[model samples]
Target: MGKPTGFMEYKREKTKEQPPLERILNWNEYASRLSDESLQTQGARCMDCATPFCHMGIEVRGAAAGCPIQNVIPEWNDLVYKGKWQEALQRLHMTNNFPEFTGRVCPAPCEGSCTLGINEPSVAIKSIERSIIDKGFENNWIVPRIPSHRTGKKIAIVGSGPAGLAAADQLNQKGHSVTVYERADRPGGLLMYGIPNMKLEKEVVERRVNLLQQEGIDFVLNTEVGVDITGEQLKNEYDAVILCVGAQKQRALHIEGSESEGVHLAMDYLTGVTQSLLDSKFKDGKALNVKGKDVIVIGGGDTGADCVATAIRQEARSVYQFGKHPELPKVRTDETPWPQDPNVYKLDYAYEEVAAVKGRDPREYCIQTKKIVKDKNGRVKELHTIQMEKVLGEDGFYYFKELPGTEKIWPAQYVFVAIGFEGVENKIADHFGVNLVRNRIQASIKDFATNVPGVFVAGDARRGQSLVVWAIKEGRAVAASVEEFLTTSVKA
Candidate 1:
């Protein structure tokens, strides 16, 4: 809207990234910020479309079509183009509590649904968003907003991930006392451990957590609610309890020899590496060492890509990632039309780094692991596999059909399963006496209220594993629900 013909005048230019060969040597974030002038030009590329689907925040065909948090994309783009950095940051925070986190790792479904993307490349919305938030921090524009008055009500939030943090921030700003419980040593649950530093630096997470603390939110770290503090105690101490303890039960590969030594879940491997890196920079020898070992990662997703990047940084001898599904098409398919999150192929950061060093992409599509062949000592030595073909059945659903006589074996000392999470851990939910539906906490999206009184659920715990932006949305929604509940209960 800032420049009507700007989309036609300027081509989309993304932020610069460190060369894969150079960045793989260290764990720092590889992407560099675009200059202010360049970001302004990119912002100007936002088309003044009447029907802007960029912030619709709806799911199309089970995939996110736009920003889940409903970020005001056009307004911020206009603000940035007009050199109103502070205003842009304010508009950004109006929807997203953690733009830095989502900006770095969210996959950017908003871009897939961008109006300009139907014809040309989408405006660099994500890059401009990161620039606005980063500038806000750099210029000291963001500060603690301590509540002037207390609502005389206490709320306890279980988990310190994005959802929990967002809920705590919202509730605290509304003058309610909030305490966030975290089982980990640090405040950020997934952002601190599950993600590698090269993608989302821990310092960024810590900076926000510190700000929340200054805003009168209490953080209780290294304490599990169900174990250290019982549900009854929480119910008695706090006016209400909100559960944001993400879906963390990793799905296990049930093939033979999967229980062998040197075979691990992807999240476990990532958490160990990140913890060790922070504790002693890996000098503690706590991290799983893949140095000089041929590594194989099963499951073709972002977690698998993260494992590939981590192994490369640890100097693995060889690395390969397997995906049962075939590679995505270069262009959008019939199943994913315009405004849907495009199921397209592009080199991810990990694949790029591996390609630079290995002279080939490390991904093997349509490959499924048959079993893990182990040595006499019970350590994984070879990964057995077979190719697969996607075939449509008479039922009109596509399924993977294994190709006969295409079996192969590959040498591997370490095998990591990155097949994704199943649901919440269940232990905490059981203690809280919340109902469960298909592994998720039984809570309605309308109110985020559980069957039990004074207890509510949100985020992955209620909706299953999803994007950080979605989690934040649920967090904000649950906060409003809790506030209304508190107000009504007082009147009752």
Candidate 2:
């Protein structure tokens, strides 16, 4: 929509990062920003399709596709192309509340479903998005949007993650008095704790939160709803309550010797290290210093990769990651095709960092940790492992089969379990008396309303543990339901 021939004039490109070797030395963001000139060119390649599937956000193959919050992709791309950065920022804020987090971390499926991607590489939507907001901040365009008057309606949000933030942002825009409660010392939920600052600088999170505070929204930190305040009290105090408490329970290892010291959850390890780095406080000497220690991370998901990279930064003597499944292919498979999440091998920042520091990938596929062994001091000494085959278990659940005589032991000073999460925690669910279908809060993706009339759930709590983008989507969707409920109540 910028220049008629803009698509033809530009080629798909993005900002390159500081080499992994150089980036691992500091706990800062790795990717370098695209220059203003290059950003304009990339944005111009948006193509402006009549039917922009990039923002359509479909449910193809029973799984969601495209942008979840329904980001106005093409419109903003065109604005950036025309050098209207401030205007682009306005258009972006029409839906998403935190482009800073998503632009950096989101796996841009919006680009995948782009019509342009059917033939050529999709527009650099994520990069363009980051540029617009960055430019807005530089020009002093991002300021608090205080509502002219209050509606006298009070609302309580149960979490401070992206979903909670999005719902609070929208509800505040409706002139409702909004308060967000977080159990953590700092808000931003997992963004402030679970994710490493090296990947996403903490100041970025603070910058947005500061702006929110200036906008008159109240944030009550270190107070959990179920603990500090009862669910019934919240319902009584506020006109409505939105539950954004994310999945906090981690899927754990079932192997023998699980109680051994030096074995910890992946989230626990990352949280301790990041908190220590922030407060300059270490555990006795240092926060899980892996220097000169051999490490084995026991999962293949994003958390596992994060452990691998974090271990390298701690200067571990050696690190190895075990994956239960077989190695993925380099290209998309039949089960996951174009426009769908590709079931392929891709190096995340942590894996890339580990490979850069250690001179190898450090990942072993089709292997499972059978048991852990501890030394006389009760610290983990080694891991017994073997390759496994895919088969049905006696319990009727499919599991990996260990081949006989394939057992091997490797010295391991530390073992971090990076497996995925279960559903929302049972304590809070039981306390609220909310029912769950499959560990997830019982609610449709379209409407996150629980059986309780005034209660709503969102984010990883509603969709199981998922990407940040999906959290935003669920938050916005739940906002619609909340708004409708509020309007109906007012009329009655």
Candidate 3:
């Protein structure tokens, strides 16, 4: 819906990042916003495809194809192209409660399914979206919109991650009184600790949280729901309780010596570093110190990449990341056709940082860790690994075949496992009496009601580990269900 011919005239330009070597010196957001003019030009690259798949917001083959929150990509792109910055921001906020968060961290599946991306590079949707909201904040256009009237329906939301925050915001906007509970000292769950500051500054998260508080949502921090207040107590106190507790039960390495000292979960390492940075800038010596030590991160994906970046920032003597998947092709493959998120090889920010300093990418694909070797004092001393080849099996499935002769040992003092999470932690689910299916809270999407009446579940707790965008989508959906339940069933 942008300039009909603009897509042919202009090439896509991505948000610029500070040089890797320079940015690794500090834990601050390294990406720089493109100029307004450049963004408008990028926006013009949105083609007027008869069917704009960029906003389809569907899943194909278990992978997201477009904006899960159903952001009207073409409309906002047109507005931005026409220099209607405020209007673009309005369109962005209509679906996404936090464009800033998504803009900064979202992998942007929307761009993957862009019609123009079939042959050419996709429109800079993520950057344009980020610019619009950022401009709104800069020009004082975004403010807390206090609900005109209170419905007196109180909602207790457990977990302050993206899902919880989005649900809280939506429920508050719908005139329901909302209180969010976080076990951590801070309000933002994943945004606060799970992510490093270099990717998203804490102040950015705090800013949105402060606005939410001003909009009449209550945040009870450092209080675990099951430990501090039981689920039954919350159900009695509030009209409804929604669980947004993320899937944080990390999958562990089953290999020998996995329990050795100096081995840590990626989330633990990230949370500790962020907490220490916020608490005392690591002056208290509480943060994990990888300085001058050889570090190896096991597993791959965004979490593994984040571990690599954090290790680099900590001045590790050397860093290496291991992944079981083979390196992706440089271009989109038939296996992942258009309208599906492209599986292609591009250097992530973390890989770029490592390459800048080491003169080579630190990721070793198609490798599997066999064991963690411990030293005399029982700390991690080395890692044993073997190369693997992906083979198509007779059952029409692919399996990894280990190459026996390729076994090797690498020196390491720290081993961060970033294999990802299994599902929701059991304590909260058990305490709430919510039924779990495959470790995820069992709730139908039609109505996110758990087995317990008046209690609902959303986000990763219900859907398992997923993107922040998906979590926000669930949060919004569950809020609607809660609103209907409160109106139709609850007594004033």
Note the residue pairs that clash in candidate 3: none
Q: Please report how far candidate 1 places residue 5 from its true position, in Å.
A: 0.7
Per-residue CA lDDT of model 3 for 1-492, tens digit only, reads: 888899999998979899999999999999979998999899889998989899898999999999999999999999999999999988899999999999999999999999999999999999998889889999999998999999888999999999999999999999999999999999988989988898889998999999999999999998997788898899889999999999999999889999999999999999999999999989999999899999999988898899999999988999999999999999999999999999799899999999999889999999999999998899999999999999999999999999989999999999999998999998988888989999999999999999999889999989888898999999999999999999899455
lDDT of each: 0.93, 0.83, 0.93
- Give residue 399's error in model 1 in angstroms: 1.3
TM-score of 1: 0.99
TM-score of 2: 0.93
Overlapping backbone residue pairs in candidate 3 total 0
Shift of residue 327 alpha carbon in model 3, Å: 0.5
Candidate 1 per-residue lDDT, tens place, 83-164, comes to 9999999999999998988888888899999999998999898899888999999999999999999998999999999999
Where does model 1 exceed 4 Å of error?
none
How close is every model to the real structure, measured as TM-score?
0.99, 0.93, 0.99
